[model samples]
Target: MERTTLFHIFAAVLFLYNLPACLSRTSPNITTDQSALLALKSSVTLPPDHILVNNWTTTTPSSVCDWVGVTCGKLHGRVAALDLSNMGIIGTIPPHLGNLSFLVLLNITNNGFHGDLPEELVNIRRLQYMDVQFNKFSGQIPQWFGGFPNLVYLNVGNNSFSDSIPQDFGNLQKLKVLNMKFNQFTGFIPRIIFNMSLLELLNLKGNSLSGNLPANMCNHLPNLKFLDLSLNELEGQFPPGLQECSNLQVLSLLHNQFMGHIPSEIGNLTMLEKLYLGFNSLEGEIPNEFTNLVNLEILDLQSANLTGCIPSFLFNMSSLQWIELPYNNFFGSLPMNICPRPLLRVLVMAGNKVSGNIPTEIGNCTALTVIDLHENNFTGTIPEEFATIGYIAPEYGHEGLVSTNCDIYSFGIMMMEIFTRKKPTDEMFTSDLSLKRWVSEALVNGVTQAIDSRLIRQEEEHYFAEASCVSSIFELALNCTEESPENRINIKDALALLQKIRLEFQAKLSEN
Candidate 1:
């Protein structure tokens, strides 16, 4: 009887010991995924300050469902996502992660991860969103990436990834966004890329990718809304491909080797809000067809060989806000109907040889905040409205009024006014006591005396030291406004002095 009882006790103990193991295997049926995750955890070496320190410990080894960054499928209890973005984790991506066959989204962006993307990633066939951007991943992107049938978003940008983009990417018919920017990719863009009619955003910016962009761009990419192929070596006449991209909102082709006239067919992209074609070899006039882009907001064509008059239609575009056409061969007069839109704010036309009178109608452009028309060949007597709107330099009326020194003197006077709140033509300043003379005496007495009382008494650090720098600026401004225009400090010298003063002021502020 005693021996049988002992035998029964031993049997019961063994059964209890085995029961926990059986329960563990059955409750979380995703052991393969759990092991893969644990393997991935083992591979990562956390930085000094990381969130994975205490929570990711082996204390509760089996239930990674409750772990940080792991989201599980409700029905199968399998890990469906692993997002370790911007975590400051340093390590190579472990291929074991591919074992999570149910993973739908995997994001490990802005980490210190390096090395090539493992070929095993092809096993994650369910992956629909994968972003490993802004990391140090290198070598050619895997050709097997096309195996992910459900992939909707893939961004591998800002990595050191090199080699040609795989032509096989065209097989991802369901892909909506493909960003491969800031890499060292080369060779022609695959002809098959535009065939994916569902692709809404395709960004291949900041690569050395060379060759002519396929002219049939608009044919297949009917749904492509945002296409950025900027800072590449793309050449040939500007693609008339925009004819089909009617849904396109933003098109940037800057810093490329593109030549020939911008095709008038660009007007076909009626949905375009921002157009960036600057820093290319593009020449000829702004096509009158651009008037069709009634929705255009920001238009930049700077540093190209573009010529002819500034288009009147551009000034009249109701939605136009920022217009930049600097460093082009554009000539004739700037358009006078600048306020037709009333939304016009930034107008940069510097470095062009555009010659004309300052439009007296400019007073109507109340939204004007930044207007850079300097370095052009504008002539005719200055408009009285300009003087009334902003204080004019004393030398503006003199011969050689358009010289660099005149601009410098004006800048110096503006700086003085900024600090002292005293304009050049203030009632307090008589013929003997000019704004410059009043400021110079204040500098002699102590720069603090001339500084605006509100500025001098600020509760911020280095206020006195800042006041002293302001006094020196006043001194520099006075030198810039010297009676002899030839003896005045040039703009270059004034800029250097200002930069030095700014640096000194910053250093003192930092010290406090």
Candidate 2:
């Protein structure tokens, strides 16, 4: 009983030293909050705007509350929030901060504060949001973090904390967002966290957290809207309960070791707008059920082992803006009715075995901006309609056009490259038989041999129309490649001839 009395007496003395009003009529809460601000101020160095160095020193009733990045209660006059993010300050956190029992939000992100989080932080019982990310804080993630009674948002990503995620984090009953990415954390993800039913966004990407995810990952966190597990060592088949997540919007699992067929159940995630599953070992054909994802805008499946003919339904989805399925083994011809409405923007499907000629119906994709079709077995001439649409350009690497009429030579070369599907620098052409000489010789015989193989298969009218267009363009290209620059055809004449060829070609297409 004597010990209790003495302890109370000592505590009162200490409070008086810090708060300056422990035994006086003034409010101890505001004084204590001021002292806490001073404590944090002591650790900060190189305050750029003199925000902390000048303003936070004076603790008078109106002084500290009006300082930068500090918010005080309107009625109680106690510090309730501190936002010091990206202030270019350096120093470790001070332990004296537990005095700010009223602090509800503390953000020191993008600063240089390092070392283990002070144990006193657990005393901030009312802290609802805390972000210490983009700092150099190292050491185990504080285990006492479970003590924050009201924390709802916690972001300590981009740090060096090397601890298994505290299983006790499940104690944060109000937590809706937890981001701890880019840490050195290892060991199985604590199963306790999945019990947080209120979590809506969980980002643990860029960590070394090994071991497969818990099988019931989505069952408990039914409110999750954005989940990013990319750039980790997570293995095993994709999480099992993913299909049950009906509200997920952005699910990125790229650059991991996850294998197995992409689940057909993914079709059930109709709300997903962006799905990234690249740089993994996933195999098997894309499920036809993907057609149901009418709302999906971006889908990335690069660097996987996925196979089967490219599905035609992908072109029918009006909302798909970017589709990246490169470095896979997908085969079969491109769909004839590609992008039925002209909403598709980027379609990257290079580094595959896809064959057959590109369809002329591709001209319907008016919104298509980029199409990467490199390193494939596509055997065909360039589509003349695509060239007419200004999508293809002539190869001028070998042909020198140094005169005022250079544009004329360029246009003519482009015209020839289009019909023959052979660029000027093609390997088959030696100096003795350049692309110019080769095309000129073919024109002397007939336009048939120089024509693109794809065009050769067209019906009678197209074949004859293509032959006439090829003959005229080939003759113009030869005139442009004359030994003397001045002898080359002028730009005006070349354009006029090209325009006539296009009109005749369009007429033939119309007849067909």
Candidate 3:
């Protein structure tokens, strides 16, 4: 009888002792969450001695919530967020991550992660924000991504994802910011995406997306503020219905094949701040209606085959800052009363048919930093104020002649300034110690001594190769700035030399 009583006591003690662990393993929150996180840790290719190597161990006394890059919901005690941005972790995402049912945010930007995202991610229905930008992720974006009704921000930019964007993305009715730039997405933008009334920022730049934008694109996008479609193969007329986006602030459509006139209807966007329509096949004058954009800041229309005199109102707009209209057929002299706005900075009208004296009123623009008026019919000498800026070639001062060689000389000075990070008029330079003379003297010591220190790292493996490349550049600059125009290297030779230097430097880097 005593033996039976002892056996019963031992059984009760053992059951009591194992009760907590048994309950933990069986619970829906504890064991499942920890296992899911451990699966993620096992999947990624972390660096040796990474903090996650030590902090993400199950042997630690801390709970799963205490692991690196993991956050748990207080009430449910489930993983709610995982952010490992810029952690240098590599490898494909594991399918097991879909088990974190409570996860709302997943950010793995600026990593080396690659491969198609596991389709099981669709199970994370509660996901609201997902950023996998600046990674090597490839393959078609899974169509199931659009099924997340709660997703508000989605960015998969700077990846190699190809194929047409799925039309199902329009189902994300609550999505506010959608960035798919720098991918290989092709074909027409899905018409349904334009119907997303809540979308505020849409960036599809640097893709192979083709076809015309729908005419009714802005009709339902009432809240749209930023739209960028640059660097694509898209071709068609500029959408006339763009006026419907009353709240639109930035419109960038550069580097496309859009043909036809600048639609006057764009004048309706009074809130517009930036307008980029460069490198297209568009024609016609700046629409008079553009004068209505009192809030305009940047206006880029370079290489668009535009004709007619620049509208006078553009120079007078107080809000105007950047005015780039180069490589066009714009005629007529710059207005004497140009640059009324103190904010005017970049004024490029190069390769045009403009004539008459360079206007002195440009001096009114206190912020003006770039002024390109070359390859024009301007006949008079440069304004005295511009002559004093120290970038004018020496021949321009002595002979007062403007020729293509003078441009070559100026370009050499600019190149030296760029590599040395020193202005021609820097305080350290004087009449006998010009930037050109200083760099010329440094060649005897070592051209690397004259290079911008920020660009050089002696400890790097390719440091000497890079320094040799800089020396070649300086030699080319000196050739361009030879005293006699006849002795200067032509722009063609300079370009070829630069190409050779670049190839050689790349080869040396590969060797290292």
Best by lDDT: 3
lDDT of 2 by residue, 99-204 (tens): 7877777888999998889999898898877889999999889889998878877889999999688887879978878889899988888888888888877889
Best by TM-score: 3
Model 2's number of clashes is 0
Error of 3 at 327 (Å): 1.3
Worst 10 contiguous positions by lDDT, candidate 3: 17-26
RMSD of each: 13.8, 19.4, 12.9
Full-model lDDT, candidate 2: 0.77
For candidate 1, the TM-score is: 0.72
lDDT of 3 at 105: 77
Q: How much is the lDDT of residue 511 in candidate 1?
A: 82
- Per-residue lDDT of 28 in model 1: 52
Candidate 2 least-lDDT 10 residues: 389-398
Error of 1 at 417 (Å): 19
lDDT score for candidate 1 against the true structure:
0.79
- Model 2, residue 368: C-alpha shift (Å): 3.5
Full ranking by TM-score: 3, 1, 2
TM-score of each: 0.72, 0.70, 0.75
